[model samples]
Target: MMRTSLDQGTSDVSDQQGGVRTRTRAAIDAPHLRTDRWWLAPAATAAGLLAFIVYSTWRAFANADYYAAPYVSPFYSPCLAENCDAMRAGPNWDLFGGWWGISPAIIILIFPLGFRLTCYYYRKAYYRGFWASPPACAVAEPHKKYTGETRFPLVLQNIHRYFFYAAIVVAGILTYDTVLAFRDEHYEWGHMGLGTLVFLVNIVLIWAYTISCHSCRHIVGGKLKHFSRHPVRYRMWQWVGKLNARHMLLAWASLVSVALADFYVYLVASGAFDDPRLF
Candidate 1:
């Protein structure tokens, strides 16, 4: 038998029992042995997520400049209150009467926000970025052990499937809003503007991100003994699987798209500039 021991900067291998058995030495004491810059990724993720949270929170509470003619901010889409008339994208939903005085965006942002917050990729991103739980591969976490999602706060992640349902509805509403964006300020058909293009691209990315979700993929085709028996679902599952491969990309792209789309609406609604008609 061969026994191996590793010290601060040395390694010793000795024959113990004159057998073929070998014991491998490990650097268990060091936090991490990585020589490269492993902190950069987590730092960048924290910065990006923090920046987006601050910007979105400010915009959500602004309660103004969220609507510009047919263009509506994604954060404030499906505006469902009487106060939405001033910033109405489509016909006022009037779901909540005059009683709800707060920003209408506050009422509807929870679903989409919940979906993103509970996302698997986002869990990994924030866990590594903010919590520093084994920040990178081969790095040891500061905590002694993990309870995982079995706890109170972490257990909420299980509701991601429900959030996926709400996200689908939100995506549908945004699709309707995008369709409305085809009209001009006068609400006439056959019109296109720079904002129209922006909305179009943003909605496309949103749908791509939403549809590529893990829940959506599972719902499309998860538990089945045979794929051949259900051809349609199998085909859909194949498509979703391919999209799922790019879920992270779609997630970030949609995040930026929604923010930029809202900013464009803000610029136009604030009267900073007119939406240049492409027609």
Candidate 2:
């Protein structure tokens, strides 16, 4: 009986040690799982954004209205001239295709997709927005350190200074286009082109995006200086910092507005929508 009792006690001790080992392993592995879950929100947001883009593009292509019919629609009235019926009668309605051998409409359509997928603000937003895999979530597993992707190309997004210059130029060109939209075939300002409104909105959206960028804020503020040494500089930085707070909001809205602007222009060029003139 004594021998049996000793053996039983030994077995119980071994079982307890095994249970402790199992628990230790589990505790080590739990963090990795939590870190992974943090990524779910951003991934979901990206998927949804992609879906809308695809649907909108497909709709733009499939619609028969994309090919302007007999009469210029009410939407084009801003540029319509006396006896302007001749411009709308033809089969060729694609302004971008006519101006550039490559369709500007298609270029505008695809530009945002590339920018958004690689945008710094978007990366941060996704990192924080996702519940399972937030940006700061680190794996607890020592052996399984999450050395996934280096944010090199992403960090290069700091080149928004260069992009700001480009955006300014583009905005100017768009503004010019807006002016052109008011001119009839006779080259006089008549009414309003729906395309003009769309183009103007696009300019505003791009401005919002460029201005709200973190890099732009830094450039404007002049990086990290002590307020005592440079109060004016510090104040400027503070103001920009305030705007930067809404950078994500500006980014997403800019993305949407630019896309819609292109879509509206495409519709007008395709003849899906009419621009009627009242004046």
Candidate 3:
């Protein structure tokens, strides 16, 4: 009776081991499509965005003449008749100023793009674009697992309100650049180059984007209980409300416009295109 009992116990152990091996093999062989389908849309979007970024950045850096030449003094002879010869010889290719020898273009490009990419709105868009194509028009489905982090770094997205302020300031600076492009370069209003038009469009795009910021909408709307009752406030809120409705579209277009503007400017400065006068 004891021998029979021991034999039965050994058989039970063997069966348990076999069950675990079968489960392991099944898991290893399972189709990844079942688990990875959610990432398809987002991954494709990200890849496209990355390609655009790489192409634009490469063009910006490769077009050396777009930037001021090395060792050129800021005090180079001011050209009177659209002659950039004297300016081209200057060492201070640094358009803005020598703040740690950093290029102003790098500074401007990094902040707005960085902030937008990290913005809560953008994060939501990216996540939905990736995991859920044709995102639910209204009702968003919740994720099965809360795999996201709960740390301060991630929580910093709350500072998007402050980033909105930075965006406005940057937009203002770009506007100033637009004005300088005409005034300093002697560009006639009607006779502007491809670069000038691109730059102007970029400014408009950025304006649309800035106006569509969540914080700007709230501030304009006067989020108080009796805000709509006030006439002036009501009108402003209505305007902001219209813009806020198209915020996502504005955001994407603005991004594209900015990159294209830079490209046009680079091409013009590099002599890839003749700077035609609009007038």
- Assess candidate 3 and give its TM-score to the true structure: 0.64
Question: Candidate 3 lDDT, tens digit per residue, 1-279?
Answer: 344533221332233323223333432221222433555555666775776678656643342444322111111212122222334222223444334232233444556766686665677666566554233333223444343536666666667777788778667766755554552244233344445566687789889888877778777765757964677877887897798888878877877887666656555656676656554
Query: How do the residues 2-83 of candidate 1 rate in per-residue lDDT, one tens digit apiece?
Result: 6566554343344221111223544144556788999999999999999999999999999899888878888888888888
* Residue-level lDDT tens digits of model 2 in 1-279: 344533211332223323223433432212333524655656666675676568566643432332222222222222212222234323223433333433222433333444554456776655444422343445322332333345665466655466555555445554555555565444556656555566566667666676666666676656766566877778777776776788777777766765565456556657576655434
After TM-score superposition, the amount by which residue 264's alpha carbon in candidate 3 deviates from its true location, in angstroms, is: 0.5
User: In candidate 2, where is summed lDDT lowest over 10 consecutive residues?
Assistant: 72-81
Q: Is candidate 2 or candidate 3 better by lDDT?
A: 3
Best by TM-score: 1
Candidate 2 deviant stretches above 4 angstroms: 1-40, 52-118, 125-160, 184-186, 224-236
Output the better candidate (1/2) by TM-score: 1
lDDT of each: 0.86, 0.50, 0.55
Clashes of 2: 25
RMSD of 3: 10.8
Model 2 vs truth, CA RMSD: 10.0
Candidate 1: how many backbone clashes?
1
